[model samples]
Target: MRQEFTIWLTGLPSSGKSTLARLVEAKIRDRGFPVMVLDGDEVRTWLTLGLGFSRADREENIRRIAHLAMFQNRSGVATITAAISPYQRARDEARRAIGRFVEVHVSCPIEVCEQRDVKGLYKKARRGEIQGFTGVSDPYEAPLAPEVVVRTDRESKEECVARIMERVEELGYLPRGQVRCEVIVPADLVDELGTNGSSLLAVLASREARLGRAGGPVTAEEWEKIEQRLRALGYLR
Candidate 1:
């Protein structure tokens, strides 16, 4: 891990913030830099588990994510965050929390985002089934001075990814000989490992937690399996 730094990608839902963040991480990883991505949706289940879409909850959500990212950065890891993060104040708070925060606006028009609503969130939002939706029911305040602006509507994924890498380098996140570990693990195994199968599960779970302190959504059956495995291993109460 290198000295701590943070890159925050913010935009409306479906506007490629998550995609760009992943691309950025890929590029950084390829450069041997220690990096972790913290995306909002993945963490919502655990870190901000009880938070709703109300204004206050949303603020707290961003706050929690920012705080965790800052903590990770302090630990000498580069952090990349992706979230709708609609309010300017929330984004600013993140930048302040992480002194080296790089704010990147994954700018794309609402129409473009709606068209790419592969998840159908836009349609659902239009039907009023989802409230507090960005670029629709709620306001998406653009960053007044984002460090970099990546226009998803106008760039290819490769190009956007490259731009993100370039920005990271420009912002000093990349340098020669930075070593970061990238661990890949299976989901089912991660859910049942009982804290002994592998260390990657803990790392992934920790990443999920840092993203927003959101815990994984383990079901009763899954919990039973983990308990059984742990008891069988004599590793739990």
Candidate 2:
């Protein structure tokens, strides 16, 4: 996550790629390095707005992100990309494009990813609201030889970010011994009824526990936002 590094995040949708990328970016920023996360969803709004969900368009989208990463690397900036990027050919194109391409495969089983439907994408895909969805309608080809692989099922976001930072350091992308941390909370809003003051943390805790029971992916940004709201409401010290 330092200079001249390109971390190509490849995984199925909802496999914790963007979440982990944010964590990694935070850690890198804390170290005073310039970093940017090119998330697929946000990138779609700008770069791939003209592209569809078909195989050809998806490949083109990946190509465009890869090109952007390469350009960033040339300018001595680190690029961390979070994209489904399920096709091996597209990933290969990225590796060829970037100078320091570190492919970090974010591995999560389809069933588990479906269960962690924090974005409601799985439900939409199931209901045929979204077509050519990876792992539902289209295929998700795993990386043949990833530079690093993080299994989302067996790891927390902090741990995954640490692994990626370690890999980037190993590839001489970042300085040695960069530590990473993440704080996640289920972003689903829950009515606290009459809860106030110190009770807000408890309420959020209970809600998060229920979300865990319901199989949701808690995110750090959501937790930070909730903490800010709670502080503004005089809920915590």
Candidate 3:
């Protein structure tokens, strides 16, 4: 990473924010950059230990994370924060504080996120066990015009990370030469490619990545092919 920047991953719980942050951190680390991840769960455990889920507390949590990210960014260190950061104003405040901030909105339907709720957070939220839960009891303000928007429900983690890194370079956060990620395509997917992989890959990396989500614009046949390719590439199970 030639330039210092903060890649802020924001999304509803289980929408893949924390996972993407770690993956991006590893990629930047591979490029010999000093990168650190401030995961929401981890930060809550220590950094903002006493914080609650109240709006004021959440904004304070974001401010504290932003404070650390800002200083790290200034010291040539990259910071990747995987926080729900559900409030728009707080996120905007963080952006103003961190000059090189790159906001990546990881969006997935609540249904999909609930399906991926290994921690059972969504279930608890739905049951009224967790108060002020985002995407259920509490409101989540989606980002407007983030540097990148990822649909994790459709894209595999590898694809999501690649897309994010690509956008990072495109936004002048990371140098062009540092954007490439060595994604290994599976034999099954490679065979399925049969010369059409490049086009499908283009679709995966395209600005239209959001098109194939459930009830999105893609035709059934097109969506099936995309899914097959993604499965072959080990991006889908």
Best by lDDT: 3
Best of the two (2, 3) by lDDT: 3
Q: Tens digit of lDDT per residue, candidate 3, span 50-161?
A: 4578998899778777876775565456789999999999999999998888999999999999988998988888899999999999999999889899999899999999
- TM-scores for every predicted model: 0.75, 0.72, 0.73
Error of model 3, residue 207, in angstroms: 40
Candidate 1: where is the Cα deviation over 4 Å? 176-237
Which residue pairs of candidate 2 clash? none
Candidate 1 lands at a TM-score of 0.75
Clashing pairs in 1: 32-178, 46-214, 46-215, 47-212, 47-213, 47-214
RMSD (CA, Å), each prediction: 7.1, 13.9, 17.3
The lDDT for every candidate, in the order shown, is 0.73, 0.73, 0.76
Candidate 1, residues 151-198, lDDT tens digits: the string is 889889888777766776676666545555543334544564555553
Report lDDT (Cα) of residue 4, candidate 3. Answer: 80
TM-score winner, 1 or 3: 1
lDDT of 2 at 214: 15
Global lDDT of model 2:
0.73
The true-structure Cα RMSD of candidate 2 reads 13.9
Mark the regions of model 3 whose C-alpha exceeds 4 Å error after superposition: 178-237
| Model 1 / residue 11 / CA error / Å | 0.6
